[model samples]
Target: MKQFLILISFLFVYYSTAGIEQAPPNFKVRDKQAVFVDFRRAQYNITFDVQNHRALVETKILFEQKQKGYPLFDLVNRPLSVTIHDKEVEVSLIKTPGDASKLRMIEKELPKGIHQVIIHSEIENGTRFSTNDRKPDWGNVSSGFFIRDLRDRMFLEKYLPTNYEYDQYRMEIDVKVTGTKRWHSLFTNGEKTKVSENHYRVRYPDFYTASSLYFHLVPINRFVRYYLTYPSIDGRDIPVTIYSNYRFYNYLAKKKAWKVMRELEADYGAYPHDQLIIYGTGLRGGMEHAGATETSIVSLGHELFHFYFAKGVHPANGNSGWLDEALASWRDKGYQTVDLPFYDSANLAAHNLYTRKTDKRSYEYGRSFMGYLDKQLKEIGKPGLKDFLRVFFAKRKLTTVTTEDFKSDLEEYAQMSFQADFFQYIYGGHMPPESGHKHVDHDHGGEENPHHPARTEAEMLSIL
Candidate 1:
């Protein structure tokens, strides 16, 4: 009995540590900024002063140098000070390949092995507050911060020092809001502990990437919040929170969220996150932020579906982003299957290394491509794409994936080669023609995709 117990303990420890030792599929040695160091953990201490309309942040990062190379991290906001290995270091800005914006690069080269760095910075709070409107002006903030880094170059680096999406690391945040009499509420996907009024400590899982965080802070009175517990099929009673500025959406949002959760769990195996948070904007579109989403009433299902694909099985880069969007859009359109061959020519997954924007065509054209693939899969005496997605999610949840990884997995499941189809449809921009259908013309620019239009910075300042 004693020997058997010891063996079980040894196996548990081995399996737990094995995942940490293996790098994620997204970690590429060719990525210029990420090649030098391996990010392991990050801790951020943030303080918001509502009266002054300013935010102060201190970040401590733990990383290891793979070789003797300079280290760099992305941060749009300039830092007031930086320290490496407990020594003050000078930093400079340099542009990486395909990225117009520059990253903060450490001045000195570091030898191989682990290292620690600290950074302090300040940002003028973009959210504004006004007392003149009784309609609950979106611009008026009692005191808070909202962060959603969905677009290219808009990761956590926009406000604090952080690594790129290719790196997965644990994150801890200490948030304190002051200079306001109104109460504030915190919304996040991480494990949250309320230390006191207006103070919180959040810790994220180690498997999270740069894009996996969704942090929102707002005044309690500014919005209506509803809470419920979902009895998940996996036996975890998941907590659900829905909030909106409008009072009328409280009941409707809760109902719709419940329905969406049920449908997603039925299609997939289970809800991947510990909790589900929704912010019904009552607008046209929405953004999927890990387990939390700021979405419109109509787009709620689409965004929630993302928690399983886009957020749960994360995209490693902009180039591979179409898979999740296409999958969600396909599901939204009732999972239609088409026998007609698609002649469309769009390189939805062809982007440079530093490019950070998902192709806009992933919504319209990408959905059609999925339908075509589903039809093909069914015709080959195999289960439909839906079944494959369920299996894929079960296998790949909590990990980052590339388009190639997705294709390889699909091929392995179907026991067939999809190389020609992917090369023509996704990468090479040439699809077999379908009779009687006119080829649609599309602008192939790398700018923000119009399908999932997000609020402008000015609009976000007003709304957040």
Candidate 2:
């Protein structure tokens, strides 16, 4: 524990008591055990700094915990070779040599009380980027590594530090990385911040790491001022930040994303987040991490909505991911629903809809399902669907959520009560009866479904 505390201090040089601003409550839940981690990594031109089989490296670590003395690290899986001043220290905890970002040092024991931890790694010959890939045309949304040239590498960390959900980890990663001049700027959350000539600390205290895992029960959420957000049609103050090693592609697309975000919010719910960012990657399809949404050059808006539906509502568990995707896809021409359905991400494949399928798990399926729900909802009133969302979440506030919880929520809504017949839809596997409105026993107070598509979604505030 003593060694762990010492390492944390050196890594976080700027560690102080001054608190950074936090997000408002709306899209997020506050828990006492939750805390944020601020990380920074700097890269420099080591050719001029290395001499006599040694490299002169300097690092700055900063950690600020609301409560202090948290169990920092036990050096279980971290890769490193450590030395303090001129003397070599005994190995036991946190040893980061070259790739500090990949270091997954878990603590064997928790600290006695709340405390902060920081550590710096001054490697021997300096770290190299050739181990990772870096390709220029690989697209900004790509999640894996890409190779630009012999000396340049575009590293995308899609499969590292495996966690149930990044939000559960509750740490912010700040990287101040510099590579070849041709590879210029670096991007993660928003705009790129330069630290030095070839060295920079490009880390944000907001990114939730544990949520990046591709699985269910993945805890991911956000906090924001719902009233201040812009609708999708009008877009919001969302920014498009591109962080790359080369200035040629290193740029900020702020206005562009603001346009798209408002347009999305106009149709969906209010855009949440102190800021919306389009993280550049090297993948064909982008993943929607809470707060930050990754977008490729082609499909941007559809994926961004996942922040609201997928991460905001569904946990990317199973079919629920499709619930958001299909609903977003049902709409046409941006925010214009055109009296159809709307979901996020992309549509489900043939295999996803039928074979090997369980519940609502595809864009095609979700649109079909939501379209059916829309008809059923018309009678029970818009509040029925809203109630369904609230009820489903209420059951599993801090635990897991299943498809049955969703089905049960809707069934009890006085609309689609899950009777013995509804069991067919749940287990025996039956798609929603086409045009659920034929049996409507109630009337909704709004414009006819076709003429005013927003009547249901926008009925509450029209301008939300």
Candidate 3:
């Protein structure tokens, strides 16, 4: 009896430590399952047993299967059970190479037609902020700061399993959270309804190809809020919330975000989302979600711009990520001079923007080219980049964009060849500067361009 109990305890500990690994290249490939299976919706019913430091989760996935194929599911290590089309089936857990703890689901010989998959599981969250290798620290807040948001916790996928890009299938989600923890306030990227005492539900429409869904359970009693309406853009009033106790947290964030929104709106038509929530804690850098972005006030504008570029006009793959990063970083520097200091034959050819590798030269060098392009457009008596973006966002709204899409649009707008310029900078060749300056060698530009007066130290402060 003692030996059996110990064995069970060891197995439980093993599985608990094993988390989901990063998806591999092959996982991105459209298998026969992807072609035959049309994913419809996912309904998540969750109960956060906070006292126990765990969540009991049940998720139902509805899909139409066109032909016989094996569908893949990304469960966190392992699921307690999975039922497909009302039939109980055995599931095999395949260990990933890079991360042994991470897992992928493989089921054999699924039949064609409408099918439903239900997953039952429990996810442990108490260690999210600890030194646990499997859990990230995003859920942790400072002593006075408390964030119990669904983003780091109650998202259904974290408990169950799904593809990396689940939002690509045009799937809607309904999430319900029930918890006895009264210290937290709940908010999600969905329509909210209180079902019962301590029980709440949120419904989301097709969330415009959201990469992930998030909800916040902030601890503060109340935070400063600001409301602004851009009637020319959307009928909805944009509500900006600062989930921080610091003085002027709301004012500084609202001011910076509003400035960026108006600037981008003038160039790109309307801002992409309805509401904006800014968290003043637990952010190393910043992140852009469907309708919200979390960052300090210093990076408030840059993160908000991601709504239009990264979230609005998404990259098709890692190779094209430069599109969003370059544009945002370029705008971050207040759109300074067109002459980029970091351009050469070696760096250009050695590393093109189309590779999946992360080298951040794409941000600096790539952004300089955008500035250069804007300058070139101005010189040719054509509309500047702001005009170009107005058309780009209008046409490619809510769609994944590729580099080719950008090139084709620029060509039509400029009425001149642009690929030659791309070859020089983007494809790894020398783009001789029109000012008779050598392209292969130039001074590395300062982080902030001298032409644009630098932001004052006080203005850069996030909290006061």
Candidate 4:
């Protein structure tokens, strides 16, 4: 027993210090005040016991502190133990700014240097196991499902120790499943490798943020998975995988996905991610993860188009979230151009500094602005908004962008001053009128969808 304990301690220490000398990727910090430390890499070893309904997670994060300050990492569940550079440290939960919940903040102040932090936690409420004859919506008899959709700041921090979306770092996850003999399959946006019968390892890119990862583990037989290789116009054979609990919709999903991919590739340059993963929920609407999506058959095209916009040129904050949704909704509406006078005030890109939720008006009001821009561009003998998007995606792939970044890029591309339009429509909450025409009131409400509940400022205020 003494030798076993020593071995475990040595292994933990070894993992904590591994690859500490390497330099982290040089990515610009979006919000420096919100995130103090620079995250280099994060590694997690998770063990899930289906029968016991337990999930044990061991995490090691390597980061660099440019200034002497206290570090903050968000985790909904408190850790059992936390060690900073092999020294045990105490942590406290404080109310996260602009969020309704709290985050775990380290109490000690550290010098400006690289540091290794280790955290151990057990997830009790995040995993749901099957009970009696009823199966959970996400889990089955021999498996458990873990999903982290970016709705109202629910990222990897819901189940793991993670930084915010402003920080991107390389991540590796080691998963082990126990109390089940059935084969389990892992679907994610990372590069996966099978280590053993029930042990799997996944490595995500160095540019992945907390919201960029899409992870799901389930029994192989629970869902029907369809795989195909799409020949891209950029001379790459992209692997596409679509899986769902219902098998009958898999064929139609694949066809729609193929058609959408072709359209997106023609608009954009190429598929930006390593692979395409789709979880067809056969529902009404969908949520877009980086390279993967949990979408309905009707919303498959819209979700897949996000890989080039939302996931490709990532938004750094809530204020910038309207760009991708507006672009996608415009594309979904057949890229219609309109010449109409705007009268309503709906500020979609003006939110608090710590806010992370996208505005609800991004669906209809933001889309109308896109159409208005398209008409303005065409009238000036320039290409439409689609052409500008193609150029924008080509230049800004795999990078974080803000509303100002989009405006500057567009101004540089079009060689015109859109400052007034952006200030009035996006930031100032008033749209500029076009010609002598009847003003349209877009402030009635956003398009109602049953699947996606409205997340307005009023709702957030209520939650707070």
Model 2 over residues 298-401: C-alpha lDDT tens digits? Answer: 44555566565554553322223334555455542222222333322222221121011112234343554455555566655665343454454444323223
**Which tens-of-lDDT digit does each residue in 1-464 have in candidate 3?**
64354345334333221111211222322232322243455666766554344556687765554556665555553677888756766666543322212334546567665556787876543212112235422122111111111111112344445543323433333333323333435555556676653466766544333243545543325344444443435556666556656657766776776677777777777767656667654234555566666566766777778778877775543334557767887888787657543576223222222122222455677678889888888888977876787788888766666555677798888888887777667645653222123323322223432212233223222221
RMSD of 2: 15.8
Give TM per candidate.
Answer: 0.85, 0.44, 0.69, 0.83
Question: How much does candidate 2 score in TM-score?
Answer: 0.44
Superposed model 4: Cα runs more than 4 Å off:
1-35, 96-101, 124-126, 131-151, 340-343, 429-464
Name the better of 1 and 3 by lDDT: 1
TM-score of 3: 0.69
TM-score of 1: 0.85
Q: Mind giving the per-residue lDDT tens digits that candidate 4 earns over 1-464? A: 64355345444443322221221111212232322565777899998876667889999887767666677777778899999867899887765543323556687777776677899998654355553334322333232223323245476777788875667677899998877665677888889999986789999877777667887776666678888888988888988888887777888888888888888888888889888888876556766778898777887887888888888887766567788888888888899898852545566665544455666667677788899989988988888999999999988888777777898898888899888888677765443222112222323235564334434433322211
From the highest lDDT down, the ranking of the candidates is: 1, 4, 3, 2
Best by TM-score: 1
Candidate maximizing lDDT: 1
Model 4 lDDT vs. the true structure? 0.70
lDDT (C-alpha) at residue 94 in model 4: 65
